[model samples]
Target: MPWRDRISELPECLITKILSYLPTKHSVKTSVLSTRWKNLWLTVPSLLLNCHDFPYRQDEVILSFLDRLLEFDPDSRLLKVKVECGGSEDIDGLRDRISTVIQRGPQHLDVESFTEYRDDDDDNFLYPFIDYIPLSLYTSRTLVSLTLTYSGLQDPGLVYMPCLKSMTLVKVHFLHAADLEKLVSGCPALEDLTLIRNMNPIYADEKVMRVRSRSLKRFRVPFSHGKRCRSSVKYTLEIDAPVLERMTLGEDHYDIIMVKNLTSLFTVDLGIKFVVEFGVFFYPGDLPKRNEIRYFLSGISSVKHMIISDKTVKAFELYSNVGMIPKFNNLSRLEAVFPFKLLQFLPAFLECCPNLKHLILEVYYSREMEDAFELTDVPQCFLSTLECVQLKRIHEWEEEEMKVATYFLENAAVLKKLTLSLTNYPRYVSDEEIFEEVNKVTKRSPACHILPDWGLCE
Candidate 1:
């Protein structure tokens, strides 16, 4: 029997549904396959175009494709539109395309403008000069999720996005700090907000980054280690989210953080270097700034789960020395990354978390460490509430880790389980040997069981 082309006989809606998964460029190619698929790409519900997909003079090609795609069916149900534009001088063309997409009432829009090359040594390199986009983007009523990278946002006079639930701004230049504040305030349904400000010189100059939102739930300022602005000025992070649940703060420049009305905070992952000035260290002489850090800690003290970075542990160690550590009575699960040298101060840091039940310790290597501080008294959590302890991400096991394990096993009176996972161990020792050595440690709690884990065996 001859083939009857059963696939092409499927409903148009189903055909477009299948085409939506493929990029618009690839989807358009299927139009030549058969007459049934000729106009299917136009109503695919998604227009995902990338400048890299097209060869030489990519910007013009991208604009041309978008023009044809959008002009084909003005009322087509474009659920999402993602435009990844490589380094280009034609910013207006990209903005025009985005404006047209906004008019089509897309639910999701993601645009990323990547610079081709950046010369750190070149004094003329101004880091991709991108002008502000069209005002229609901010006024998008149908956009549920919007992600923009390496872009500039103009003065948001009257921002309003009623359905926007998630927004991510990566290195987006804002004319004024109030622009961000107004933009966030206008989004009534915004729940997830992320700001990647590693390359923003304006943020450092503004000195204050206020994130005030009532409906925001999960917020994050992802780790920007080596990617800080060249400006020497430090910034302040003022957060006033009444209903925020989870927040991740990862930056070194925002030394002074002011948080308020975070009543529903469940988890907080912290990693702040607290280097207020560019070249200045956070010395003990700086009492006012140090006190501000205390205020920031007390603001989120009610969080039930906290994942702290190794830098935060160092900050906590410094705060502990000056008696600036705040009590985290509500914190039940505490995960902290500590370097081998900082292991000595873990006990003192734990003293602040009196009700901590679970402890996840990830130890790494560091070259520079502060002078050792020894604590004579045991942490209150270790003696009472702490039950489960997991030692993970151990690149190399050393004597300091063993001492920490011994201390936890001997002091955690109610400890029920202790799991250890080793990765990239030294060529000399085996996992079995490390397990045997850890097993020899004395357990104060009779019910304690030691378990060894080989994480995700290759």
Candidate 2:
């Protein structure tokens, strides 16, 4: 590559296009480069501002910048507007300024309000202030995507948006479920919605928020473990999107969830923690049978692809023990991450997925499996459907682990690729010995490729 300043001779429109990708501050700074670039900043289609750009709560700089930016052109159509609210005490005054920009018909709006002023060393911004959004922003027909992350956001009453297709609300508080419902009803074209740490008032009788949109295609309810609600009332999430294709849920223990329709769902990823009875000890009676379980199992059974953590696998153990797991006729690709305790259910889960073709098992060997499962027969899928198998996090010199690995390698009739990657250094034996033991198992098909990557030992 030759270093050349010829790039500067490109057409003004092409230069503006490149400048649009830079931050608003950088775009403005480009004006000093040359006379031709002086006025080009005004044509930049996006404005991204963080409160750190101005001294905390200093309104003069922000106001002057906005005034100049807004006055640059009344007809200028903004492609994106993103602002992080920090150190502003006058909530209404800030809303008016933000409203001035959003009213310009921006296609995307991202409003993030920080609770505390963070120094340059810290990347995390704590949630503090509630941003009262101007009502006009929600009514914009030109807005296609909106993300609001404010701690105590009041409802932007009477949303009339029609062209909006995607919305995300993080830590945005609402007065009631009706407020959220009103927003959903107004967006007739909404296809995707993600709610992260959103707080909507739940009545005594109705504890959960409900989103029922015919056009909704993707839905996510990602909750962090750190999120806490002081209220004693239990809240559940209910979604009624018949056309939804992708769903992701939970990084914490969820109350109850009712997904009304998932007939079109294809993929699901969950870092799930179910609300089972808590105790310092474990007992067989603690397990809830399938009928007793307010089963989320049935709702996601129709998915073709899934990634579930060890917590999820353990949560399903009670049902698997009693053979209550529903047959996953539609599921094909599956990834199961197992903790020490959840390893027993690996074979049991395979039995339920008769059509699974791609399998990835990630084991976290952190404890002894006192109650390991004794598999008598290979799963039906291993003989007929399973084609690819990836065994990740396998520790060295474990007899039971080798048995399970050999069982799959020996019996998988239609297997094409088998990957075995060691999780740690060998305890008492070498990786070569583990390979020999695995080779002792009969290869049902000679074409199957067995790969042993023991890089951890080296």
Candidate 3:
């Protein structure tokens, strides 16, 4: 058939919807495509602008674009708007543009590096210090999803975003606990929330952050890696979400944690970095910290799937030495990373996860790893419900590591599959040689099949 422009024949609203997905720069370029598409770009109802997408003078170019784009239809409601600029010198221009768009009623808004600046005195760190934001943003009636990076949030005297569902604040500063609490409280319909605090030395003071919401389902506080110089500045996090399904607490230490009404919580990522320095493992003397750890674990004892980091494993070992680790009778899937030395103590930790069905144990080496250890007793999961085990990240094919595999093979009566994912193999050892050695381990479950994975090696 002869060439036919079928797309152009679609309704003008449909064409505008298509243009909304393209970058504002690309959308404007469509003006030259045809007479019909010329003014159509102006009605896109979305602005997706990035400084790098333009030529030199990133700030000036974006500011100019925003000035004209908003001026074209200043009263129209924006469905989505994203403004990402790298320059900090002329950040006010970007913020003004953002504030202007917020008042125009945007459903989804994302602003990154909007206020990140560096001081000459502190050449070591780039401070994400935002002094103010449009109060209208927190009370946005049309906003459904909001993401602000490198920004500061002031207590917006009142917050009532009736339609907002998801919010992500990365390196965002809140004047105090009340500012965050106020912002979260205003979003009545928020379902997923992620708070990644700025690691600036300024926010090192002790503070309490409470999150209470009825509609929230997923919440996360990812670990922010910075100088442990302010490790002593502890935070007390309090959460009261009745229907929350998933939560991730990645801080190295929390002085006090209160998680309430997480009856619906199913999965948890416990990447708690026990307040301890590197190379020093024994914290037997810190009974208060031990109590804090036990208290936090007790709140989420019903989580079905759990992920434990290496630092947390050490904390578990320490707590296990002093007292009982919280029992997770409901946990079915468990993923944990352990140093070579902590392998012997795995049974002690697993004893609490009596109903675990799937286990992924990642073995690695650390300089601070203990020299001598003893496997006290076998866990109940190994003999009962445990069906699948994945021993991954195996760097050293040492005798003790092999014994760990044999320990599971000889104990997990219900195990159906055992996967060995190897990493960092010795130059002299062959793949067949390694597999042959593992195959020799006596299996307690006759139906269990052993599988070797070389993907990690590649």
Query: What is the C-alpha local distance difference test score of candidate 2?
Result: 0.72
RMSD of 3: 4.1
Pairs in clash, predicted candidate 1: none
Question: Regarding TM-score, does 2 or 3 come out ahead?
Answer: 3
RMSD of each: 3.9, 5.8, 4.1
lDDT of 2 by residue, 237-265 (tens): 67778888888885543355677777888
Top candidate when judged by TM-score against the true structure: 1
Off by over 4 Å in 1: 1-6, 58-61, 113-129, 198-205, 224-230, 253-255, 278-281, 365-376, 395-398, 424-427, 442-444, 456-458
Clashing pairs in 3: 252-273
Reference-based TM-score, model 2 = 0.83
State how far residue 119 of model 1 sits from its true place (Å): 17
On TM-score, the stronger of 1 and 2 is 1
Question: What's the ranking of the predictions by TM-score, best on top?
Answer: 1, 3, 2
Kindly list the per-residue Cα lDDT of model 1 for residues 109-177, writing each as its tens digit.
Answer: 988864433445668654445556678888888999999887778787888999999999887777777
Provide backbone clash counts, one per model: 0, 1, 1
